[model samples]
Target: MIQDLRGANACDADGCDRALTEPQLVFETDAGRREAYECPCGAVTITVARPESSR
Candidate 1:
């Protein structure tokens, strides 16, 4: 099952909820992982929460 655990790390604070454009590995944590995205206006970061069942 596909689940979206995206947070409010909204990109393009200007006026666009830019999706993860240039998704690059940013970091990882026991909770989940993070990826950085580049928007024409700026950059944003998002993290996915790991499901308890998977761990």
Candidate 2:
């Protein structure tokens, strides 16, 4: 089963914008994870792999 993670830090492609507030659960997939931010203008982002050292 896939574990659901919430409020992970995310940023836009430009790297100029970062999620100011916690992200809401949107969905998850094998390719990556998706989350929605509080900002209405915000776009969904995919989460990459977790750091090996962190595990």
Candidate 3:
């Protein structure tokens, strides 16, 4: 598994696991970056935190 240190909530509201695939670019903003993942059950949203120094 990818050891992404960034905090993540890898499941949907129903508490289901996703068959994650290569992330596809969705968009980005000044707060952080966003990527979309394909899933057999549902979708996953991962948010990576900006570096403290960059804040």
Candidate 4:
């Protein structure tokens, strides 16, 4: 299942001018949780948040 975790202000991609304040698509995996942020320039930035227990 995919979810939005919220807390996004803008696109993190370089040379992109997209103003977005919505949460990214989140996916849970064995490695960790992944957040996919979309940019207006057809770019997608993915960030992973691992559990503290695993670290």
Question: Please, what is the whole-model Cα lDDT of each candidate in the order they appear?
Answer: 0.53, 0.47, 0.53, 0.63
Taking the tens digit of each residue's C-alpha lDDT, what string does model 4 give over 1-55? 2233244355556877575544357788778887777766777767678876898
Comparing 3 and 4 on lDDT, the stronger one: 4
Question: Per-residue lDDT for 1-55 in model 1, tens only?
Answer: 1123233334647677754444555566776665655566765545465656677
Name model 2 segments beyond 4 Å from true.
1-19, 40-55
Candidate 2 C-alpha lDDT tens digits along 1-55: 0133342343444544554455566565655545554544555544354334554
Per-model TM-score, in order, reads: 0.41, 0.32, 0.39, 0.56
RMSD of 1: 4.9
lDDT of 3 by residue, 28-47 (tens): 67765666665556555564
Worst 10 residues of 3 by lDDT: 1-10
Candidate 2, residue 21: the lDDT equals 58
| Reference-based TM-score, model 4 | 0.56
Judge candidate 2 at residue 11 and give its lDDT. 49
Model 4: which residue pairs collide?
A: none
Using TM-score, give the best candidate's number. Answer: 4
Q: Which order, best to worst by TM-score? A: 4, 1, 3, 2
C-alpha displacement of 28 in model 4, angstroms? 0.9
